[model samples]
Target: MTPEQVLVAPGRRHVYWHSALTVVVLVGAACLAHRHWPVLERGAVRLAVADQGWLLVGGTAAAATWICAALAQQGAVVRRLPQGRLVAAQFAACAANHLLPAGLGAGAVNLRFLMRCGLPAGRAASALAVKGAAAVVVRAALIVVLALACPGVLRFPRLSAGILAAGAVVVVCLAVVPAWSRCRRALAAVVADFRAVHANPSRAAALWGGSLVFAVLHALVLIAVGQAVALPLSPARVALLYLAASSAAALLPTPGGLGSLDAALALALTASGAPGAAAASAVLGYRLLTVWLPLVPGLVVLTVLIRSKAL
Candidate 1:
């Protein structure tokens, strides 16, 4: 076969596979929506009569998340990135993030954007690692602080024997196949990046500050939604519940934490004294502002960026 033919064949296969994956994800989402149609309808009806003012507040907080994400991304590396494209890329990345499980889509988009900005592939990957680590730390810290600030707001659920056993098994399996050298090297690189970023006081501030604010903004979205639905929980309590639920949802490798986050958030709210219907309504409104409302526009941005070769 000619070299051109060989190269074209793989590209064609990749396109076909990507198309198949998109179709599957869309079908899955449709099926999920259908299965939960009754619950969704109730939530929608409740949201229709919810406080519009608070709903608008939730929407504003949702929009700010992308900007905070961009700030954290910039702070991940020492070099400067194009501000406009960085914000645009974060917007597009949010769209991609919901299409794939875990954070793969968002990570891929950011990695590509960084490389396009002239960062080497390794450095780009490390930058992503740094940002992700900072995000985790910030989220965990917020959860602790909120829990403490609002005493008795969050109650940890009891783990079943089966779950405990399963977790132990998984831990043992992971321990059996430890890649110590690779782990050490990756950790070393991340530590070095952390040191380099902290060397610049501004970068350090942006890194930690952006990460902290991003998580807080997300929690604010939930809090506002709860208020809109007239949930009895205090704002501080609602934010604590959101942080706790979302942190737990991260364990499940669902796309943008779709099913997992929704279930966890609703359950947490209910367990924390919110009425079942109100909890569901608040969760629905939160998703509307953060995900559904932005999905189409974000996709358009993604398309524009791709077509313009900006991604």
Candidate 2:
């Protein structure tokens, strides 16, 4: 390349990488590693759980959400695979995500599974992409609901500035969404074929309803975790904090989003007036509930698949 071209390319590449690193660092600092221990005491855990029964309810709902998410994607290409198989594929995809790092394991697993099941790559990719988008929209909706439902929670003086800035940036990004060439095309295409997707109202409803339920399950677990550590916090407040912690972890590509979620949850709770140590302990317990809980079921499903020579 010419000297001028090299100089310009270097600057752009450096900027791109810097921005990427910044986001990862910011998320990590905000979301990973529950460093507080004072809040996570054994006695607190025993008493906290005894006070509420939401955790069990939330777990059941989360499992159901995964099933629904799988079915939703399957409904996209009804002719290629049976409903039951599609749902199984969903569990396998999630299982792979937990087993592998940086999101690679899940994608490869899904791709191979789809190919083995006789689906064209395009169809499989499209279906998964659609389901993923539905998840994001559902998450955003959940955040908005929590924010509105608990005004006291949203009115955090310390996080107030950051919240405003983030909200503004999100708003600007969404406003420019139409200008993204591929996004525009995709939107146009989906709009064109909306009738068919809506033809089976039951499937569409399941997908959306499943989306909301999945988000609520997220809220409930965090609230339970907080309670388990003896936090006197309101469930609504807990929901908002969980929203921030989960969002921060999602921004990171870390395996299990482990440290990030722990850190974020503990810090958020501490910032809200809980002792740091107690918050940290709760976060650890919370991570076990949110991350490892799904992993067990995922592994069991994988064992069944392998034994059947499905993998």
Candidate 3:
């Protein structure tokens, strides 16, 4: 076989295997949902009679998340790209994200898009890393500010504050430490890229502002869902709970945090005094607006982008 053929052969095989794995994950999620159909049905019923106006607002918020993501992504690099295409890529990337664990699919799609837009591979990857770090930092800051302002909203296990502080420091150090000498160069590149991106005032503002707004919008979506389903918890409480649960769920390696995020959200809501049924309903509504509703269109957009070589 020619060299080209050899390379193509491995890629084809990998694609087949990845497709199979995606199918398995979808089936597993379906089965789990079936097992919880009764709860879901109850929740659905509650949602059916909910305030349509509020639900509309929630849906709008959910949709706006993609736009915010695109803005933040663009802000990650100084390179100018077509604004419309960038947002479309983010929309399509959401579907891609669901097909692989730990955001590999989304990262791959964005990396390809960035390279297509003329960024070098290393720079593209560094840009992505910077965007992710900015997001984490922004979210952490929000959590701290909210937790302090609304004390007792976040109830941790019986651990002292000092212990929690130490644990957080240790975790941060571990995450920041490079595994080997070879990786240090990559780490330094990331730092340099981060500095370069933020050096531009507009880029820095877009990156940080978009990240903060994205988090708030997501929280607002959850809060709107809570209102739609008549969740007993106050809006502020629901927003805080969502931020906490979603952050915690990020630790899981599941595709889209599918099962993990759902469970964590439900558990948090229920724990915060909402009835189990109400909590389940709120989650169902939130997912319906954010995931299930947009999934098909997102996939269609993804396929078109791929076939057209836009990504």
Candidate 4:
């Protein structure tokens, strides 16, 4: 095989391997949790859902956030994604993230969608990579914002190391080699693409709008989770906890950051004044609401996109 073919071959193989391992690991985790799984399930079923009114409020907020995030994602693509298609693509990503372990399936589906749009695969890859990096920046900002906004975080010493390590890493990634040049030379050649997609105020508005809304809804999710666990933490604490835990989960290799999401959330909450069990329960519940809730829509979107040959 040619050199380009060699690079392509390994990536293809890795994708397949990651996808396969994700399925295997999920099954294994489930089987291992068999006995305690029931207890955990039962315990989780007893989780207190906020009042119907609040649930409606929460659900609406969440749905809106998803829509906004969809718009932001669409804004990233130079050739704009149709409203329906954009929403569908995001839902597919979300679905893949939850059901698939490796979390790259979302990127995989997205890359294919872009390719079908006549955009090269490299550009598609870069757009997603940029978003990934943006997420990292957002994460750091969240922590810093929380620390400055919520002085209460210093009360818990347990989270000190994790938070510090995270801040340090974020600084390095953004400050050091952005890696964008090395990542997408071919895509970078399309100079007008970014201008076409991002020059207008509307696109920036959409992205900032979505990102801010995402943060708000995320805090609300944490509040709902805190309520479920009887944690009584403030919104500020929850926000910081959310960022910190998610950042840690991003470091994990597990599909969708499953185990790590829960574990990190638990630790962060505990450090933020929540009891371990309750924090665990809250994290579990939030995952149910935030992660699994959009899954059905995602699957539907993916199926529709595939039928339309978008992927």
Candidates in order have lDDT scores of 0.84, 0.61, 0.82, 0.65
Q: What lDDT, from 0 to 1, does candidate 3 have?
A: 0.82
The TM-scores, one per candidate, come to: 0.83, 0.68, 0.84, 0.74
Query: Which pairs of residues collide in model 3?
Result: none
Span of ten consecutive residues with least summed lDDT in model 1: 1-10
Candidate 4: which stretches are off by over 4 Å? 1-50, 152-198
Across 1-311, the per-residue lDDT of candidate 1 in tens digits comes to 32222222335655566456555655665676688778768877898999999999999999999999999999998999999999999999999888865676788788888888998776777888899999999988888888889988777689999999999998777656756556666678889988999999899889899899999999999999988989899898898889889888777656788877887887799898987778889999999999999999999999998898987
Estimate the TM-score for candidate 2: 0.68
- Summarize candidate 2's per-residue lDDT along 172-241 as a digit string, tens digits: 8976885576656655544433445557776577556766666777677667666655666888888888
> What is the C-alpha lDDT profile of model 4 across 254-309, one tens digit per residue?
66777666667766887767755566566766776777777787788888888988
True lDDT of residue 129, candidate 4: 55
Assess the local accuracy of residue 27 in candidate 4 as a C-alpha lDDT between 0 and 100.
66
lDDT of 2 at 95: 67
Report RMSD (Å) for each prediction in the order shown: 5.7, 7.6, 5.3, 5.7
**Residue 213 C-alpha lDDT in model 3:** 91
**For residues 1-311, what per-residue lDDT tens digits would candidate 3 score against the true structure?**
32222222336656666556655655766786788788878887888888888889999999999999998998999998789888888989888887676676678778878877998778888888888999999988888888887788797679899999999999777777765444667789889988998789999998998888999998988889888878998877888888899999777657787877887898899888998778888898888888899889999998888888887
Which stretch of 10 consecutive residues in model 4 shows the poorest summed lDDT? 1-10
